[model samples]
Target: MVLMLGFVTIVAAALAAGYLLGRLRPWRRAGDWAADQVRFTGAWVRGGVVRQAVVVLVHVVTAPRTSWRIMRTPAADTTAPVPVRDPDWVAHRTRADKGGTP
Candidate 1:
């Protein structure tokens, strides 16, 4: 009887938590969560909150430059290739050459 009661209580608690989360779903989309997560420590963070903030700050500033330094830039092509032949102009001729077809 006690085991059955304990199982019932755990299932009831799970359902209650699920119901509460479902009711609060609309409030979750109020802002960009990625930006917020980057700017500040999560409420779940306990003693190491300040250290997390410093590490995230260092990443934000230095990582972009380090990535840029590794990137390769395209070298300019200084000269254009010389054209060898005249373009075909068969359609644009004002008169047909010897035949009725242009």
Candidate 2:
């Protein structure tokens, strides 16, 4: 069909334009500049990721030692009663073991 031929012509023209632009001197310089910008952005992101990974690795490596130190401290009390946030809920339940009802 004529429409299909027109579409093919348009695609071929676009390809030829792209090829010429890619091969020409000024466009090649522009392409290199664009590539450098992408390279710099990628490097920046990579550096940030590496820096955060190092920070996480440090925390992971020191966590056990930090926990052990806190556990061994004099202020760490094991015999303290843990306070419940919902102590009143026990009164509403049935105590089958003690033969008590709600």
Candidate 3:
């Protein structure tokens, strides 16, 4: 109980000191300066957010059209047999492409 009272008294005293200091000229000026800095930082953050949103919007608008163009294009004919110069390298390449132990 004594400890609790001590804590409450300390909190009240701190609050009162803060209230009195906030009324002083220097403290009020400091608070205003801090608020201005916060506002400046907030504006920068908002600008970055807006720029990211615009980039995402552009990607959203272009992605489907780009994908559709790719899909509509004819695939190249690859029926001709290409001779592998090195069978060992070809086996390793195939294994790597399949994401197996290479």
**RMSD to native for every prediction?**
17.2, 20.7, 20.7
In the predicted model 1, the residue pairs found to clash are none
TM agreement with the true structure for every prediction: 0.30, 0.27, 0.26
The C-alpha local distance difference test score for the whole of candidate 1 amounts to 0.57
lDDT of 1 by residue, 1-102 (tens): 999999999999999999997887633432234235443656525537785565445444545553344344564578668877636656545556645666
Candidate 3: tens digits of C-alpha lDDT, residues 37-85:
3334454346676754543344334454643564588977876688768
Q: Can you write out model 2's per-residue Cα lDDT over 1-102, one digit (the tens) per residue?
A: 999999999999999988887678664454454444333545434667775454334433445465356447786466668787766766755676458663
In order, candidate lDDTs are 0.57, 0.59, 0.60
Q: Number of the top candidate by TM-score?
A: 1
Question: Which residue pairs overlap in candidate 2's backbone?
Answer: none
Better of 1 and 2 by TM-score: 1
Measured by lDDT, the strongest candidate is 3
Off by over 4 Å in 3: 28-102
